[model samples]
Target: MSQDKTILVVGTYDTKDDELNYMSNCIRGQGGQVLSMDVSVLGDPTAPTDYSKHVVAEEGGSSIEAAIDSGDENTAMQIMAHGASMLALRLYREGKIDGVVVLGGTMGTDLALDVCQALPLGVPKYVVSTVSFSQLLPPERLAADIQMILWAGGLYGLNSVCKSSLSQAAGAVLGAARAVEKPKGDRPLIGMTSFGKTILRYMITLKPALEERGFEVAVFHATGMGGRAFESLAAEGSFACAMDFATQEVGNHIFGGLSAGADRLTNAGATATPQIVAPACYDLVDLVGWKPVPEQMGDKPAHDHNRLLKAVVLSASERRDVALAHAEKLSGAKGPTTFIMPKGGCNEWDRPGADLHDAAGLAAFVSAIEDAMPDNVDYVPLDCHINDAQFCETVLSIFDGWLENGVVKA
Candidate 1:
């Protein structure tokens, strides 16, 4: 009974009133405040909510009558989703809500995603859903920091099993709200992308170096979900600069591999954020290791990084296609961009006589990048491999120049 935080309880209160109220009581029991938002389109809650369905629908730019007249459940829910998300954002901005806990099945979960995404990163977003970890939830649909607990056995009515999930979710959201230390924007932030240190070692050196120079460095893994989070921050204009070094997600998007969506490398450019780019692992596409290799990739050399991931080395032609894709994405940059081409090799595994080395493939990729280099991007071709000391120094040199020229503010 020590915490004093407000938690937003969102759901189709018309049907799930009892369950929602149970969660609200749990929060109150923990010394937390509750604000209820009803998103039901057809029925009313037994008691009036702080924000009624009519208020939610109107906030989304439509009326309840228009939603009923539409006669389409999907359309009606979309209207509610838009309204609820906007209202949730407004509540957060006004400092009225500290965290959000949303309850639903598939339809409710769909609306929950929108509402969670409307809030900024670091605001606690918890979802209690029947399809909590199901494939129905794609990486792109999720907010960067969303948490979900499976709504077990609570679909029809509240049971002991489901009560466990609801109570835990209630405590977790309230606890997170009390303990969270949100970004203070104290230092200029740099968003960088790379794999683990075994494959991409630039972050090991660059992070401390950037910190010494008064910049906060956040390095994101280039896997599907990691890249999605990086792009989300970039789109928010959260980073002063983007060091997008590990761009394997671009090749992954091209070759039916694990992807960060079609917009993997374009967010910073779209927001006019200065970006320094390198294709650290441009020669491979990552696929889930347990899945059967696609017939087209069956003949390619593969590396099992772990039980979770497998990397397929692209052929020379495929490497060229990826290089051109990078160029195409960079060509539309609205701000300053620099693409560094490491002529020796792009990744450690592709270096001289390494297990994954393919000199011809590297040559093709380098040539494609040079030939397709856009006018706006300053293309610098270096003699060292991407993991070499010289490559890291070059990056620092460019960043230092930017700082001096006021392109990157400290």
Candidate 2:
């Protein structure tokens, strides 16, 4: 028999009472238990909630009276958001809720992001927001696995148009709760990052090879969003080892292109996860293809990946900056660290005769990496392209040594 699934319905119940209750009813109609949390600073819901406004406020280290006394909408909402997020996390930890669905226009959505982020990646976190998919929310504010549904025409009262969104969100969160299969941790898991096989082929060789050594390998795409997910898991100490080979997101973050965040390369180090690092694709930054090219890129050679993304090759000086940034980030690692330098090239596109090949830039990057490498890092330089067989062999050799020395758990 399946376990009973409970979905937490959260909203500003004082203002969105009908909408919140309707969503709760929808979940109940589908045989899912409903736990309502009211995050309202003032006013009262038509019906009492499972977790009330006063409870949420006090849990956040303040009270409803204090929130109202602040006399600023932003301040009051922040207090409520903090409280709601803590309460949501507490509920999940106590096994009182399986999934969470938060409803709101702007204030509610803002709080919802914090609440959802407080939960781990696997638990279903659905946000029914008026600003769903809007650019207003930055990549860092998003939880890696969060699901958002646009609360169309549902800002004020209950209506058929709004009901359509609410009902789907209700069903989605409940269904997700019933179906989620979280990480089992049966085997030591390795988190690796790379782009497409054509761009970065190391994963194609490394993944199966690592699995053969009695490990599970998860490869992230190394795009802005993908890097965020990798960092989130790394911060949680989820990876037995992190083979972070494709690091384009670092360049992206530095150049104000499609960025993960400033914390893109810092999480694994902070968590003391044994990390094997490389500057793969460190010479390029990704920009939105459909938008006007930023002035700084200034006619630099670019590879148009698709209508959605364009890879901009950096100058020799820019590549040097990237190299220094990588070294700086790696210097903070608390666990075992190895820095691999594939001297010939970092990616397939940067090989000789390739479209993005820049011998001078590659040389500059190599020199900078050698100069800035921290004393804590074990630097390994190989005269091979990152896509070459020798690069994969070196990685495995380092990994095997770590295993034998107990730097990494098998």
* Highest-scoring model, lDDT: 1
RMSD of 2: 1.4
Worst 10 residues of 2 by lDDT: 1-10
For candidate 2, write residues 81-168 as lDDT tens digits.
Answer: 9999999999999999999999998889999999988899799999999999998888888898999999999878999999999999
Candidate 1: segments with Cα more than 4 A from true spot: none
Off by over 4 Å in 2: 1-3
Distance (Å) between predicted and true CA of 233, model 1? Answer: 0.5
Residue-wise lDDT of candidate 1 within 46-112, one digit each (tens)? 9999999999999999988998999999999999999999999999999999999999999999999
Task: Give every collision pair in model 1.
Answer: none
Please, what is the whole-model Cα lDDT of each candidate in the order they appear? 0.94, 0.92
